[model samples]
Target: MGVEITTHVLDSPRHRTSYLSAGPPDGPLMFFVHGFPGLGAMWRPQLDHFAERGWHCVAPDMRGYGGSSVPTGAAAYAVAEVVDDMVELHDALGGRAAVWVGHDWGSEVVWSMAVRHAERCRAVVSLTVPYIPGGLTLEHLTPLVDRSLYPVEVFPLGQWEYMQLAIDEPELVAEEFAADLEATFAVVFRGGDPMTLGTPSFTSIVRAQGGWFGPSRRAPKMDRDETVLSEELLDTLVRAYGKTGFLGPHRWYANAGEELRAGRPGPGDSRVRPPVLFVHASWDPACETVTSRLAEPMREACDDLTEVVIDAGHWVALEKPGDVNAGIADWLGKTLRTGPHPM
Candidate 1:
């Protein structure tokens, strides 16, 4: 059976925001947040899968993406504001504490929700990015670096370099990259192997290489990895992103601040009291887990957390939807056998 779908557009002056909801109004709800340079539609596959299995899935365009309200002020994109939107969204749906899932920047937002507004999340599933409790600032993130992969002196900037580029030339970066959205999506979403780890930081290459696509102004052709994402699926993504210039979505990075950038829980900081799940992308070179040491600290922080490793790259949900869905289903079975009550 097809799931029911509804969407809302919020206008915040800077941009138009769109959030799509699927499945029955009364079904268990799951909020899916997308990462940088992506819109709510990035969660299409997961939303389709979960909605069919009695989940009311909601995917938002976030503050600056799609039809959502986008305020020009960077402060509007703070973690607190994003978390507030989730809470308000839940209340609008006649429910509270939906199973929250995020990927990339979305993962950061979901992490903040669990930490700052634990009461509003029944459970959380974060993909790619892990929970870094503390203030979400670049200054606070220095200690969490795996020194071997990212040396202090040369790479102190780390991912900040990429962020800086985006912030400095948001329009140029968006227009240049979005010129061929297909090639851009393919290169960015191309799955890496589980064997490659501790490679030189990509952040270091940004200024010299001119962003993640390397020296090329446009993305080069990438080999199709059918095992991870099908050609048709890839085509759909290309079309979606192509139609929506990345400026609205990419700006979310500039919108975030030092606190949100840190992503680590702080002393006396709010803990994620709700049941949380983290699905590690085993082959994600950027957030590698072959070291084990990388995820160990996160496991120790949450009171109720579940960790599952999927043999996929940064795009875990897209690369291994079955495993992702199953991991989430298993968690839901154990945690939400009885559906959530209306708030």
Candidate 2:
């Protein structure tokens, strides 16, 4: 039998963190952080792969997800708050400078760590989302949207209009997504569709449409996208979201201002100095780094940056796990492991 991935919980004075861990306890640390409506289990592929190679892999159920403490109020889910939770967790796990990996909103958390406090991380690998040193706020992102694809007159906020859901109607957003877990997961987990490349993502019109499923109020019935999800993984996600609901995840969108403010230069640290590998989702309409200028800030902000374009959708890590793992392994082997931060 392979090395078993173990579940652990740290009850710190600040909060309770439930994380999945593998590899030898004394091995080099590789922390994996997930995004909205996700658990630490979402990173099972990367966690298992890295663990087998003598890297201690830890994927945490961030603040409001899975087995972690789900604090009430959107203010409690701010970027600074989540960053503190992670740093505390890091301290409990031996206080070593480890390589951190994140996807979607998790990218924001890791990036916040590097920008706000670089001492905790040796390197960072981001999937589908690039490092935005100034945070993921629309104020920092809307100007970077593809104007041709999302014209200002038509799409004033670009594909980020959905962010308003958190501000305008948080309960409704949570209620709708939690209304039917299976259909919601299936609807959102589809793999890339090349035909939808330059088209306006559904996110651009979320405000006008009212909700994710418009007047329907819940996800439309659809088959789970097996291309991106294993049956076991899918079931686990449903149960996690079922238990937590969507309030905590949706609250992440409400704290963009604080996140952006937290990323500004302090004291001597301005640019992110750690080795960064940004994995872009080529077919993701909302984050089209290949075509849009969405990745420009990241290019200018990082002193040491590596870029790889993966032919997949938003769920690049899940849909193309081999490619994602290969990209990170190549970067780590070439940049950190063999060069400086050896395992």
What does candidate 2's lDDT look like per residue over 121-174, in tens digits?
788888878766567888778889888888999989899898876678988999
Q: State the local distance difference test value for candidate 2.
A: 0.86
Residues 288-321 of candidate 1 have per-residue lDDT tens digits of 6546455655676788887888888888887788
TM-score of each: 0.85, 0.95
- Model 2 alpha-carbon drift over 4 Å, by segment: 257-269, 337-343
Which one wins on TM-score? 2
Q: Which candidate has the top score in lDDT?
A: 2
Error of 2 at 120 (Å): 1.9
Clashes of 2: 0
All candidates: CA RMSD in angstroms? 3.7, 1.9
